[model samples]
Target: MTDEPRRRGAARTDELLRVTLETAAEVGYAGLNVEAVARRAGVGKHTIYRRWPTMAALLLDALSRVWTTDLDYHDTGDIRADLREQFLRSAPALAAPPIGPVYRAVIAEAQADEALRATLHDRFLRTVEESTLARIKRAQEAGELVSGVDLTFPAEVLCGTLYYRHLLSTRAVDETAVDALLDMFMAAYGT
Candidate 1:
């Protein structure tokens, strides 16, 4: 009812983001084009440009939406069990065909672009850190974690391992790896 142009503009921007992710996965980040995204999204080229000025900016926006952040970690009063649970939850997305490539591309891009780095930090890295912080804080209060153990360090160690393994090795995160990691964390943190 109020300002139909603005409403359609917002809808077009959303559509463009969705289509850009699809195209990036299919064609790779280097191959992304504004025209292709516009055609696929059924939005005009001007609409996309108005929303995102550059290709990299548009891709960053697309990656932000594509990576799901709806996950919430649980505290079972056991750190080891919680790590295993997070591992299982992440495995599926790690195994996703589009997710792996998109994550790799974003990581590679972040090295060269400051804005892209910020996008990754806000969209992906911060979310993981926040979830881990909550879980670790719970473990500490429950006395399941070791005394004087830095909570953030363990989360970084484990999640960093998974990220590198996924990006470089291109390997599917498996239950065995999860169990082995949990075993180490349990040995260090179990009280």
Candidate 2:
């Protein structure tokens, strides 16, 4: 009997998250607000506030649900090939609708909001960077990459370059660009 309330709460949370994404897609982050999301979700504002203290937090959670899979790298015994596969797989999400715009919006807002910036790094960027670093470390252990090297910069560059292109430049992060990045990484780090 007690489980019923918890299940309902979980279901309501999922519904709210879905509505939040839809609202962000419809209006962009600048137009998103707690009251608006609550109204759109057919719930009161307190419902959202109870789950997330701020709209940024809610948006982060919504984005996290959809963006998790691409952050993970496959261990195919070849670091270059595995990274290439993961980067290619993730490129579309950064360039396409739904996730891309909301992500860009959050990043832009974070530039002015220190709290949001910290939360963004803590919640999202750290996960991506950690995953990339872990993959590289594994490759190093297996002798696919150079030994005794500080891989942190390489990992950051690998992820940061794509984000820079996606968020700042007019250029596309197509296959050629990804290959070029991988080629550089291999030239620098590969054994």
Candidate 1 deviant stretches above 4 angstroms:
1-10
Error of 2 at 48 (Å): 1.0
Work out the TM-score per prediction. 0.84, 0.92
Residue 95 Cα positional deviation in candidate 2, in Å, after optimal superposition: 1.7
Which digits, one per residue and each the tens of the lDDT, describe model 2 over residues 13-113? Answer: 88888899999988888899999999997778988999999999999999887774567899999999999999888889888877888899889989999
- Residue 114 shift from truth in candidate 2, angstroms: 0.8
How many clashing residue pairs appear in each of the predictions shown? 0, 0
Model 1 over residues 1-191: C-alpha lDDT tens digits? 54545447566667777788889888887677899898887667888888888888888777666667355777766677777888788777755755767767767767898987887788677778778777877888878777677778888877877777787786667888888877887777777
Model 1 TM-score (2 dp): 0.84
Candidate 2 TM-score versus the reference:
0.92
lDDT of model 2, residue 82: 94
